[model samples]
Target: MMIIKMDDNQKLGENDHRRLGQELDLFVFSDLVGAGLPLFTPRGTVLRDELLRFSEELQAKYGYQKVFIPHITKDELYKRSGHWDKFGEELFLVKSQETKDQMVLKPMNCPHHIQIYASKPRSYRELPIRYMESTVQYRDEKKGELAGLVRVRAISIDDAHVFCTLDQIEQEFTTIMNMIKEMYRVFDMKFRARLSFRDDSDAYIGDAADWEAAQRTIEEVTKKLDLHYDIAEGDAAFYGPKIDIMVTDSLGREWQCATEQLDFVMPKRFGLAYVDSDGSEKTPVMIHKALLGSFERFLSVYLEHTEGRFPLWLAPEQVRIIALKDDANILKMAKDVVKKAKEMGLRAELDDDNETVAKKILAADQMRV
Candidate 1:
């Protein structure tokens, strides 16, 4: 294989995603079509499907129910959740074609998940309900800050929401932490937890006591689990505190992976309540979580972390069956191998060229095929 070397100063470099993305034939951005959006090619589509599969397998083992929601929501929905008021500057709003009714692209999935919880009356027995989905979300990111897949306007998230009572909060959070650990472990990446708390900033919400309580809760949970973590102020959400996983890449850059936020306002605003064991109506505590955060962000992080050398488990083209001889028999065997590999759920392809074995390996390495 062709080995590439770099100087110490340029070591690991930027990973030059634009160049690599083109070489891999994954996705592209066009200024003519508008900025901050991407068009995924066939290979990119395959990669996204693999990511979805990874999320599904993990959710299944964690007893999460997969759910689908519409991309558009009524203006009132966001209004109730206070996103329209708080995040209006970053939202994309539209008027319905037929009814001229106001609608907006969903920026987050927690509001939708809360509506599902409020759809019907729930009992204390259903205290810890976890709903998961891999849905496309949007934001009006500044053009200047937008980059390839890493920073995009329209993105999909491996998001989930856990509705549980206060009594079950610690247990549920622990379970979600374990879920994040499993995801990181699968990618074989080392990670640290960041307890993101609100600072004395204008964007923070709730009282200082409330924020401290939430932060303390997460810190205590991590401590109890013996998970190593660092505390970061001013990294919290406007509505609550969160725990963000900071993973160090091969290049030693830290990226925020999984996130678990304890939200007290969204559920209250949406009027999400259930009958408690004591037979009193109580609001269910909502936990906003994403094991992989934004699929776009996670993929970009993983791509750089591995330096485009993805492990076989997540490699877009896991195997390339190339024919050593151009004879009919060899071609047929290559085709057969491709079919068998696909049937076994491996992402394999038949390279149909007369390139030497070494040359083919070098090409695959570059394309991350």
Candidate 2:
């Protein structure tokens, strides 16, 4: 076992994700790999994949389809999305070695997803076209913000977008809201909604009428669902209003996780449109929804929330057998149990070693396996 002594200032709890991640052999960060870049172990990768699959399957029930996008794109993509003007400093710029081509690691998936929608001339019949992708997004965050998974240079977002007409906006948004509620219910997270509306300031885009209509529609949903929420002006995105889901962690501290946003400006900027029944082109509204804003950040919060003692379904190892004796018969028995568990599709393991039973049990308890 690797042990490092800490000074007075460092106070990671017994089950802190950073501490547990190391002790549980989940992930590690090497100095050679640089800060904010984590290397996940086999077990850690399984945990991440399981969470992602769960999110995808849950969203699939709400008319969402999986869509894929590249990790890098040209700078013009962001410029057209208006992200260049706002977040250009945070992007990781890449220049071609053979040519003068310049590219950037995507800071957000909104622009790429828009391309999918605009690939073909859509019609009113396909009013709500929903697409989802669990992909990593890159941002060159400041050194001060670098930590375990809380703040990372590369993060996976369970992101989705729906292009719908003005009349279908409420229904599409409501579907996303229901999906968010179901996700939180599975995790047993206590949350409240924040209706983020524009202040009608010069910073916000789109017409005043569009912003007002969007805000009022979201308000109606919150009221219909009887959700507890507060209005926060000037909290909306530059192009739209949003409903931000705020979850309270085990320590009673609150953190924003999921968000469902309404955007009217980007579609217009991209010239994205659909044919109406009257045979005229009309701009479609884009809804940006992220159930888990950042998959890495969500794991960090969940690990701390459950203190590494996950329920059976989410636990890395559901059962661990420690042989009381080192005899051949006992070791074989333990191996057989593990084999049978595996055949039954269970995460089980046999602890066969020179260590004493008491020590093995202590180690298992520490891992919560």
Q: What C-alpha lDDT, on a 0 to 100 scale, does residue 67 get in candidate 2?
A: 95
Model 2 weakest 10-residue run by lDDT: 1-10
Ten-residue stretch with the least lDDT total in model 1: 3-12
List model 2 lDDT by residue over 154-197, tens digit each.
88889999999989987887788888889888888899999998
TM-score, one value per model:
0.92, 0.94
Question: Candidate 2's error at 271, in angstroms?
Answer: 0.8
Identify the leading candidate in terms of TM-score: 2
Q: Write the per-residue lDDT of candidate 1 for residues 7-74, one digit (tens) a residue.
A: 34232334655545666777787778888888888877877878878987898798899999999988
